[model samples]
Target chain A: MSAPKALRQPASLRLVSAAFLAFWCLIAAFPIFWIAVMSIKVPIDAFAANPLDVILGPLTKAQGDGLSLLGIVAWIGFLWLTFRVCTRLLPALVSRHAPFGSAALGWLIAALAAGVLFVLLGFGVLVPLVRALDGALGLEPLIGLTTQHYQAVWVENAFWRNFVNSMIVTGGVVTVSLTVGTLAGYGLARSGSNLAFWILIVALVFRALPHSVLVAGYLPVFINSAEILRPILGDAAPTLYGQPLAVIAVLVAINQPFTIWMLRSFFQNIPADLDEAARVDGCTHFQAFRWVIMPVMWPGVITTGLFSFLLAYNDFLVTSLLLDASNQTMVPAIASYFNRETTTTDQVEAVAAAVSITAPLFLLVMVFQRQIVSGLTAGAVKG
Target chain B: MKFKTFAAFVAPSMFMMFLFIAAPLVSVFLQSFYLTQPVRVATEIETCTPGFTGQVCKTETKFLPQLDENGKVITETTFVGLESYRNVVQPDHAWAAISSFDWRGLMNIDFWKALRFTLTFTLLTLPLVIGVGLALALAVNNAARSIRGPVIFISLLPFIITPVIGALSIRWLFVGDGILTRLMEAYSGQDIAMFAQAWTIELLMLFYRVWHVAPFAFVIFYAGLQTVNTDSLEAAVIDGATRFERLRYVIVPHLMPLIVFVALIHLMDAYRVFEEVVGFRSQAHVISLQWLTYDFLEPDDAGNRSISRASASAMLTMIGIVILLVPLLRKTWRDHKGAH
Candidate 1:
């Protein structure tokens, strides 16, 4: 509203808003934080003990099984050194920007104070209590941290195969969808025809269809095609039943409608004069698209490509139904980890696998947060 | 552009759309009317044994695959008409339940149980998602500049997580000896098993849906907020309008289109809920139409799949989507005509 007077809301309202935002922020981030922590913890610590206790508890004698007293001392000394460096160096860096940066200095001091509290809690209270309890009750180590679960999932579980399958499928989908969708979207945007309009409408309708519905239709066709081809192809014919190509084809088809719509809007934003200008320069429509429009449309193409990759990468229904056991992608592979046959230890490994799959996506989102946010809003707001 | 050039450009997408999308739809419709299985026939096998008096002969009836003269196993596909659909809807059973005044009997039917939950899940979460999302948009819009970026990123994390992972995360929190379960038990001084009951699981699923989808609505609403007419807002403020009055009068009307857009998308997505049922392992308690189709496709003890029933269920799901989409389609058609 640009009302300067309205900006000066009461302090109470501002405080309430801040508190509310903080509460929701915790709710949004805590599960991920919890999973990250659980992923690194030893299996016993992960499943046997409460998560809060594991985070807050000190190292018991059993937890210190592989460690020497000297190691503990070194850890304490390292923490102290880190605390001193942050307290001394951070304030100096802050004061250069503002002459009176007392708030910055206060924040630095508060952070250091929290570090001191954690050290005291870890060593003085938690360690002694755990050691005493262990000595009295002969209790085993209840909490310990290790990266072994990640290693096990990577090596013993052959997760690399699933990761590669996901990459191949996603790569195939992104390339195929972008290429075909761009052509179609450009056509629909530049050519004002009844046929193009009808095609766009049909694409919209198809886009609304659920993935399971499509999968249901594909099952019979794939099975029948495999049988029909068996006499000619011999032993290789059955590959169609669980082949990655079949899954990729379906993924591209399902994703094409959305991709086309997104690209159409993007293409529409580029003025038609550009195409006319190129035509006047003796270039055909395809030539104009390849040489002139594409460069200008690169950002939109990339955004659409990212969305396509997400569709293929994140899909479960098609991949699970189409791909056999050995060919399962990461989502379905991780799903297979959850069953009645698995024990608590396996559950820990499953959680670790979940973390493994999510970490890369988290990093990707962090890197492309702006693009993803814009792409998501582009459809709804424009419509 | 000429029609030839346009066709050349769009041919690939058109071919794919026809092959995979349009054809599959037609195939699904046709498949709903046909049932395929191995052909079986009764055959007689004779056994003779030498006895003290004479040779005793016995004939036994056995079921065998029907074979032609070429010795190839015969498979039969027959026109089922509306039989598969009848099996799914169970109209006779539904009538019995209704006439006998047995509401529980209706719930016992898989189709109705799944339908009741699916509708409840979709319709109930609509208002909650929109309300929470709009509230979040308003809050984040007012948040300090330095903090807004991080807040938005954190809020979007829930939505960004894969649907299965998101559902599982919530399930883990409430499952036996999980953190939230432990906390609740500790706080109330009583043992509570969240997954042991139907209502709790349904409640958690509803909560999860809101948590996972509100970010989408928030993003749309936030974008809409940026386009609000400043002149009108200023005029309202000058007329001594309070914050709530200004919001209701100016901002709400401005965001109405975006609200409808989000609602349409959400309805389409929520209608075919599947991942949550699988992720929560709630098949024992709750199911959806999509899951019902998948269930029908699962092989039984004899390794025979109910493809006919699955096709019927898939068709039913599409019908539901088409019904929900009719209003939106009508509006779109009207807009198209007006623009022309």
Candidate 2:
């Protein structure tokens, strides 16, 4: 097509477009907005009677329509400001004292925020919707909040135990998935042809199975394994049946495929000549991978690893079915607290559990704010 | 040395995959076929008669013989043909659906409604996600460093965060008494039950879905945007093309491959639509095929009748979606192939 005349624009137009895009982004990121606000509101103020009225500007209960829209805007602005202040200071803290420059802390915080943001999404959104039906027809939340839901959940060694269960499950899956997916991806990158195509199809299909079926199919096998596995390391053998290991096993099995597919795409981006150069320099292929290829693929590996770690940690169905009641993860605990009869005080804790689950993750996102936005979509645009 | 070198490079991951993945999947498929066999009975029937049914059988008719008082044979139950599969296929025949009262859920109205609700939900959500995703990709891809990192990070945070928190926090935000509704009531001057109203719920669901996936959309498009031929873009810019013209004739046409790639991934994930809907839907039966599969697997007396029907429904949804998107995927991929 031939060039068209340019529209004359002042520099302000570009600035306006930037502002408009930022505004749309804030709207799209509603939970993140709710999160920073909820974090600081002091729980009592968060749920005080007539709680919605407290928002600034047009959001006073006196004016409802413009109130909500402005409330949303105000909420977004509030959260962005917090992020700005936090971001500005964090690098300073790290740079000023290099000794505390712990890289893993960023990952931990991101995971925590992931847990927090998710819980807020569910309770702030799902349970209330269910309860609203009750309210609309003159009813109450299905499981209203209570101090007891938190108490019941907290007092139960089971609930705390499940958090450990999830960690083990997520950790096992991540380790196994990365080990296998990375290798398989490397294999595919070097393979001659069509098997790679078939494998990619397999990777995608497994990535897409409803875990309900996967877990259901697993139940009987696990239940029946007591007799056969008793001999392996004796009756005390870390049985796969109902263990957190079972949950992680399925997760590793299910999730490994996708990263294999993703890493394959990025692995291809690594030049073949790098391996040749390493060989010419007299490094064995093993040395080449350890010294060269693996390091080159580290960023891809790290991104893929982080994604898989989050997926495993966030998963509900696999962990729930294979795990016993005492073994429930954060998702199931959050679901159970609401689904079971909960009182209002318990409701806050349920929301608390939700926030606590993803809080560290949000912190991670703040740290990696640079890499995530860049590579987050990398697989999609190319793969 | 080179061949051994290549072999060495690939060993660890390959060994791990075989032991963990291929082993389990093959083993599970084999196991799904075998029901838990009762080589030895847990308890034999106590006495002179056959069986009663439902609540009556195990409680009231407990002591009857393998043959009931009526002498109808009762105690033993064993392997049946894709009996579970058959249940979902001919759901009417299986006992009333196990999930609802009185078996009425078998011909699940809630299931179908959820399916329909999901359709409308996806229709509303996808555009917002894709639109916002692409817009961010275009705008940020052109911006300075000051605005880029933070904007894209927050934009993409929803995608990277674990779904447990991500999904729930989102649900909480728009809940009926949620911050969103409370704000809506204050702003609108009329109390709107954000989750209680159908249109409002639809809007809320769409809004959350967009927020949840918009990051993915932005990330994918941004990734593609990185690969764009800047020289090609500069040539168009130098030629005096308008911004819209550049987007249309230059950027969009150029990003066709990425667009198709984004659309395919979104279409696949969107139709699955479980985590988002599960977070949002509790009141009205919002029908979607994924939820229907979930409903099918809810609970049955003997075992869940899932394999065929759940797979069947999923397969059907996939087929339907593919049929719809095939032309687009093909047209876009084909057009963009040689150029990329």
Candidate 3:
């Protein structure tokens, strides 16, 4: 539809707005883009005094460690293919072949399979293929690109263990919080009692609490947990401090309030008529929620799940304070790299690790942009 | 829904929240009033060490924590009502500095220094984020329809990236001849160090937070813009209103509630600003309330933490947030009552 005559913007206004938008987008995206570029080059090139030298990486080329034109093309093609497959083909395949009651289960399996496939293709097939092509062509390097920092971070420094720890923590947090939150949110949404309103008010207050206070309270108890559990479990009781389970528990608690609030708003958007009809058809309350409401709630669940995943994945204060050195998550592990004395190579590795952690987030945003945006506006617009 | 079923449905969530959040809050409150310290006893010991000629034996008296039979340190806890808070606030020292009008002296105190930066960071970034977010929304609204998706996708990157990582990205760009610092130096024909001083570091922090959060506000405002009454806008234009007049009168008034919502969320989040302090390694030059608590609780070489002080600091931080949130809470309460 065309804008009304008065609503249409003048050319100058449109130009200014476009320019402002371009400037804002650059301010928003440039740091991420620059960091990814810096992570691939050698430290000398990455941290060069001249921005052009950093980009061109002549010193890296002189060091004989840079990507050829063919190598760059292969890498881009592989990444694009992976993105397309994971975002489109995989989800479609999972949903189609999934059993009637197990689509979520199917998606989980598919996601894991896709992850494994990506690792295998990138490292197993593509690395070797690129090396062979570059060797055969004997072409000059086009731009600096090195995986040495990534290799050091993931292999030499055992950063994969941290990545695994992060997965476990985030996974547990999202699963538990979503399961609990959906129930509470639905209950609160359907219940119009004074008690429900009070509960929600309390939850809002709880949600505003800074996490440090919670960590402070948990610290002493966790440190002495072995003794606390000794009477029931005898001498076999384990200390809760520094365990991934402890971090998960704390994160789930921290995330519950916001989760319930978001899910409640989403549940309210779904008319009560649907579930009321189910109830009239002889489905019990629980059954109505299960067989009728839940299927329609998947979009909302997925959106809330994305947020829970981000909170648990991106946490620093709780993980850094509570987790043991061996059980540190990716964010805290990267922070630890800067805590101690470090060489130029070590700093570059930290940058590599930083870039690696953001890859999963980038993919999530790419696939679920609409859901994330809607979820953000849902509360403000409706409530 | 019946009360019985509602209780059953919410049982697990309530239990977890009560167990983790409510109990911890109570404990933190109580802990602030109590101090725990290891019992120290003076003991005489002889140490023999290798010297230049022969083994040297020296006798010395040392005060060390007493360990129990199980190899755990013996500790004592005492009720010291409000003492920890006093220690944290340092009322006497603060009063002396204030009476003398020694602004620098007051800032030399850790808590005051942190409070200064935290408050300034929160308040200064508020308007900038709202302004940028509104401009972005208006821009995107007026843009060609085909490009809005790409523009939004690119803009959301800063919001979704981990906060600490975002801070680190800015830190890397400007720390020690990084790309931005080099560019500025080249343009100005002078050397620059962004992290060397307080003001520059604080400025970068404000910029980073605004960049990180404006997208969230933008998305909200953009959604709000979609529902703006086009009829009113057309009428305003017929009335000979300029573009600025239209925005100020029509668009902004419509987005007011959303602005308040964004402001409330920003206040709650920004008051606890700890990540930038950690990510930028700004403890030497700047700190925040949350960082102060963490610092107090961080173990030193002796494996001792000032748990009471940390608790007190945490309580203070919570109180500050509650104070800031009081107005919003009151408004919500009134709205709830009206709805009822």
Candidate 4:
């Protein structure tokens, strides 16, 4: 016997839940908020470590000297919590008989209100906090908010090349994993063979290893590949080290087992009769696969492909290992940036870098949100 | 199609796996056995193979025992069986141990301590990742489908960042004169040195690490949540079950497989943590096996005692994972069975 939803619903229950949600959302959005705030600060106001001063014309050291960035963030966090609690509490307390339209309208108004509050905090609380601290500490902030960070982050040849590198590697991984894993999956799903099971286990083992350890192990291969290839292919031996293809190979290999598992599930849901029917119609196994099985597997393939791309694109340990100094990925370069000497390092620039890198992919996920969601649930729910 | 033709259709991919994945992996294990360095292996190959016409290779697999006691040459050559393993376990043997104050002690911690910390890091990270992660996942899942992609993408940003960058950013967040320090001093009129206490430092590191990684878990969990039986929830609710009960009886059981899988991944990753450890640079060291490997790279930092301890540590870590993985795999297998 479980507690009824109505029975457990204390007057403050919604309030607390809403508050927790707000706090989590605030925590989640902190870095982005900090970045957007720092972006608007004048050069002198953003870089300073403390005694930060806000520049709205002439600036004053932030009032109530006991304020900390954590406190400020905490304060904002509390405010968010308050807003969430009040809205939920008030709405529930106000009326049970309110029209559905009125309730929906209330919900929309609250959401919009929350959105505006967050934006204001990002602009209002965060910027001044960074600025006033800089002023108080006598540290010069990185002056002027501009599109330079975005331009530098995305417009640079390195960024574009890295993007291309990601595409190539990720594409290769998806292709290889999909093709190989699909066939293996077909065997695993159709025959339910132990070999397929074993294959999947091995693939999982390989993929599951600390990627860094795998990257370290791969050092030997990258180092020795030149020699390994020369004898077999002679002078025309295609150099593989630091090539996007290497990443592709690694991604394909890493993704293979997972792909197999996913494809197997997708294939299992598909009736063998369909496969059999296609076979009876003068279709060779390959022909039937191309004409029959491939189409049915589209949903799985699309999901897997997107995942593979993201994995490859985001892969740091491997890229850091295999890629040379000249060919860094977005992740490693950002990782390495802290080691570099920046002229008045803007926190916002770093934030902007973070944002720009994630924005495109996030948008893609947004656009095809249903597919990703379905993909996750699809595998899990089958159990 | 006949079974044989089906096999034919599968052969290309299988062959590719065998040639590329299986063979290279095997070769890595074999390389571990060879006596010489990687460079020596490559260079020695062309001249040394007994029968090969192409690149031939030879190795001095035996050690001269002429150095009787502390290199007081009074003996002849002797065959050493698995001495590397012996040497690695007792890092005090073979090479003068790394004792450099600046660089030593990263990897050269007792094999046991390193193992303990590795497991601790994994266990510590697990709840933070899964609990908060599940919440984030559910939130994003329930968010307007319009924002789902954008929110998820933003959330997982840390995952794609190189560990170096990820860890560095974390360090920046908590270090003295860091955002946290600045923030704390402003609010409480107290300076919080994040790195002074092991637990304090560990907590911060744990928080940052989980923050960075939870999104990956979120994405996966969110995906899993979508496939959960909505009808079961409706039924549970109609039958008067609350959210907590519903989650436990219905949603949780549904998510068990992913939970196990995610845990397994985090376990493996935590054992070999490196880039972040270096970046964090806290005084209270949560030494991991990787630190040992990195220590070996800069020998004489740990008194050049020997490479034995580090190697022993590495081997032991592998063995531990092998030991722990069995039960976890059993659970996964059982769940996998039940799921199907």
Candidate with maximal DockQ: 3
The C-alpha lDDT values of all candidates are 0.80, 0.59, 0.89, 0.59
Winner on DockQ between 2 and 3 is 3
Q: Give the worst 10-residue stretch by lDDT in candidate 3 chain B.
A: B296-305
* Arranged by TM-score, best first: 3, 1, 2, 4
DockQ per model, Cα: 0.57, 0.28, 0.82, 0.17
Top candidate on lDDT is: 3
For B1-340, candidate 1 gives per-residue lDDT tens digits of 9999999999999888888888888888899999987798988989899999999999999888898898977879999899999999999999999899998899888999899998999999999999989988888887877788778778878877888888887777777867788888888999999998789999999989999899889888988888888789888988989988988989999999888888888998898798899889999999998889888876679766788888898999898889988887888788888888
Candidate 2 residue lDDT tens string, A272-316? 899889989998655766677886676577677777877887776
* DockQ: the better of candidates 1 and 2: 1
Summarize candidate 4's per-residue lDDT along B1-340 as a digit string, tens digits: 3467657656766675565566655543443444332111112223365565675565544433334456543422233446655554555531234444422443443443455566777788988899987877666654446665546645645555545545555555566655657888788988788777667766766776787778767777877887788667778888988768987899889888888766766776666666556556552466566665544423365333233333334444556667767786787688668856
Q: What proportion of the true contacts does each candidate reproduce?
A: 0.50, 0.38, 0.79, 0.18
Query: Candidate 1 lDDT, tens digit per residue, A1-383?
Result: 34477545778877888888888888888877787766666555554336665453333224554223434454567556644544354444544543342332343344445455655865577566656655776655543455567778889989889988988888888888888999999999898887887788788789888777777788877877867788999867765668888887888899888998898888988999999999999999899998889877866786787788777887878888888788789998987788742676677788888887776566445544666788888787776
What tens-digit string does per-residue lDDT give for candidate 3 at A290-322?
898888887788789889999999999999889
| lDDT measured at residue A131 in model 4 versus the true structure, 0 to 100 | 60
lDDT tens digits by residue: candidate 2, B103-181: 4454344444555666666566667777877887877865776777667666766776656566567666665556766
Q: Where does candidate 3 chain A have its weakest 10-residue lDDT segment?
A: A99-108
Quote the B-chain TM-score, candidate 1.
0.92
